[model samples]
Target chain A: MAEFWMSEIIKECARQRISLAEYIIRGECENSGSTREQVIEKMGKMLDVMSSAANGGLEAPIRSNSGLTGGAAYQYHQYIGQGSSLLGTVMSSAVEMALSCSEVNAAMGRIVACPTAGSCGIVPAAVLSVGVSHQKSREDMVMALFVATGVGMVIGEHATLAGADGGCQAECGAAASMAAAAVVNLMGGSDEQALHGAAIALKNMLGLVCDPVCGLVEIPCIKRNAIGASTALVSADMALAGVQSYIPFDEVVTAMYAIGKQLPAELRETGRGGLAVTKTGLAMYETLFGTPMSL
Target chain B: MNATYMTGSYSVFDITGPIMVGPSSSHTAGAARLGKIARILAHNSVKKVTFQLFGSFAQTYKGHGTDKALLAGILGLNPWDLGLRDAFSLAEKQNVEYIFEPVTKPTQQGWENYHPNTVRFLITSENGEVFDIVGCSLGGGKVRIISLNGILVNFTGESPILVTRHYDGPGIIAAITSILYQDKVNIGNMRVDRKRHSTTADMYLELDSDVTERVVEEIQKIPGMLNVILLQRINEDQSLNNIE
Candidate 1:
């Protein structure tokens, strides 16, 4: 049988008078043939990894193996410590945490792939920053993660998560959408509101291409994660204020997939289009590998 | 929804996790998984290995740390292991020799048909046993073993499996199935491959659950069975250890 759809999940939760997280927990238990405790324990371990990766880069300037991207997260952390962030504490911390996690990923430190490694920073940054600032307990954060997982599964099932296949709209866009849902859930928004948040986040990122400079995840990938966190927070806030998406979440995901398919191969992580082929981008590639960019 | 393209059920962890060390899940993490499975199939006795990388794997393997991750896995390190960064040194310390040969030209006969992110492992054991395994990283840290020892086969590394090399003859398949049925073990999928005019063939059985040592021994006793190896699912719970 096919897995349940987002609409089915929402209807089931409504019919059973249960929260979205509880419904997801039940679905996971049935689908994977694991006990409730086993699923929770696995999620708990994932949360632990996310927590560390969110902080791993801020504590030190960990450079990528290519020596291209590093120390930006640390610098941003120091800037936040100086209280100079234009965004307030919670949002600013989300951006910093997102940068840190992406940097750590570029350094090859361990991370939980929230949809994907390139987009890994967004979900943890959004959930942890908002949850911790509001004094939500660890269980509350884990529940928020379940909400994110639910949204990610729907998008991953219906659309795509790989940049090579669906561009950055699928990776960073899916991540921001998932993070928005988690943030909305953590703030006590209803399931509908959480989905609306996901819709808004994804709608904002439609058509974003996956053109990594030099074919590394270091260049635009790291900074794009920071922007994704900010977008998630804003989308969550909008959702909490009862703002509605013009299109449904599932429809939005389908649109994203269609647009991704329309993108040429050069823009889909090929490093031959968009910002990857800028004069400086090519120079960086040539300098790093002692060869001009090909293919 | 288009159910035609969507067939499998994904766990929450499958959507959110496989907690790993990475810059790219398909390149770094999935490549490591393929190497680890090859190591397990070779009984962890890899003395030398040659990774023939194709297409994307050949072009960007070094940038994505696919090379190090592959070696680390061959040296018995999981994708989440911190030692992945030092995989080259670790392989050297373990006396495991490795080479990365990038097959960039499509003119190489039969090579153009491989996946863009494919790697063929030519692994030699300490006792002189050799294995040829070809695998492809199917994005999101998922992998599939596409070939073994020049015999075409297909299986994702996500399942527990029994792999056998035996002389192709009557009653061999029935004998193996009877043993599994007696042990109450169900085979989820099965594939038998043999080259034309070849007496030796390979059988791959993807199992619903891991088989016991006793069952393996029973299968080993069957006449014409050259070798039987049980490969547990490589992406088990232990690989998700929290980062230190």
Candidate 2:
């Protein structure tokens, strides 16, 4: 099994003259002891789940048990129908799809957590919305997942994916970066361009905290996923247009981990600070679970 | 700091914990999985069970649905099961009496180094057989069974596993390995844990794929082996159905 750093992955792609997807698939097969066909089948299953979640989230926007989030995705969809938005159909749909997944999660419905359940919506929202709008083939979408997984692997190898360990940046920021690279790959960008997309997406989200109100993955989490998808799309656009990030993807991930560590314990999913500590946030908690003893 | 997050090999599915009903993966999904595996290990109809939660699990169990998820798992439901929401009522219908208790840490006497998400199960079967198991939820719906009845053991539901308990002696591992080789079941990894070296021991082997019933019988016939349990991989386990 081959382990790759950012430099090694780039070099292997160049030397082997294989696409980044193939390099990643080969490494995955070797490490997991599964055949290429098996890995592809698993990726196919994942794509199916993502599509189901997006549709389910929108088709029935049930309120969460906490009542902190629900029906917002549907409202966003309704707004798109009004033609009152500046964002295009693709971008608007992506944001709505992202919100759909998070809302579904909050309602105790099924969702695929791309990295963590708190940041579940970013990759699927970006991939499915953009893929459907552009009419990308199933095989192309599966290839896109390999790209996303490859980038996720590098981040998982070098940085934390758990918010408790590295804050919201490690979860949502890492997921958006993964989605950016995947979107670039789906659009026929070079591997180098894909890495740049990831770097640009992550660079913009440095030091993002993970302060879910009342310790639930609703409230800001659902909206943040929407913004994360938009960030992914915009970063992909810049990378495809030949914009370069001064810091590479690996360094950006390293910085994300460092910044997450520097975050106060209150800001790292403890529900003691940030939005969780706000007057409105406390009031919502009081309404739902009753007044917290500390407050 | 070295600035690295490398841990172990991850499948593409690892990035996405298989489609699950959840408000939280560590608390809900992981708790369900622990319940499901404990049900299988019990090997008989569960009459009653008690869950002792430690640290983080004890802190926020009710709000996170950990309580419901755990009961749902004991009744043979997966994390993706919509019925998870009704697990409390379902447990009563199934005649599976259950209770939850909070503990600051593992009070199993000798065991230390507990994961904050750890839970200990004391399960009693209809046949009046009783057993104790300890497991830890490692976030993202992943779990590891760390012990059984105070004996050290190891298992993660990632692949097919063959767990055996036997008197600690010689050639026990080789006997199982030879049968697996003949059956063409590739061994992914193996771990042996004993209360005392050369005494009673538990053997855990992860297989690349499933083994046939005939192969299992052959291993069960080994001289020193007392009990053998075959556990399917989480995906292959029929307890979970894909939502879509």
lDDT of 1 by residue, B1-244 (tens): 4211221356788888978888889999999888888898788899999999998899889889999999898888788887899998788788999999998777453644667889989999999999988888888888888877765666686677788999999999999999999988899999888879989889989998767888889999999999887767655675454345
State candidate 2's TM-score.
Answer: 0.88
Best by TM-score: 1
Q: In candidate 1, residue A251 scores what lDDT?
A: 93
**Residue A119 miss distance in model 1 (angstroms):** 0.3
TM-scores for all candidates: the values are 0.95, 0.88
Clashes of each: 0, 0
Please write out the lDDT profile of model 1 over residues A203-248, one tens digit for every residue. 9999999999998998899999999999999999999999999899
lDDT of 2 by residue, B1-244 (tens): 3212222456666775566877788988899989998888788479999998887787778777889999999999888888888999999998899999977654646333568788888999999999798899998889998877655667787778788888888888899999999988998888887874466788888898888878889988999888887876655423333444
Scanning candidate 2 chain B in windows of ten residues, the lowest lDDT window is: B1-10
For model 2, give the TM-score of chain B: 0.85
Candidate 2 residue pairs in clash (backbone atoms < 3 Å): none
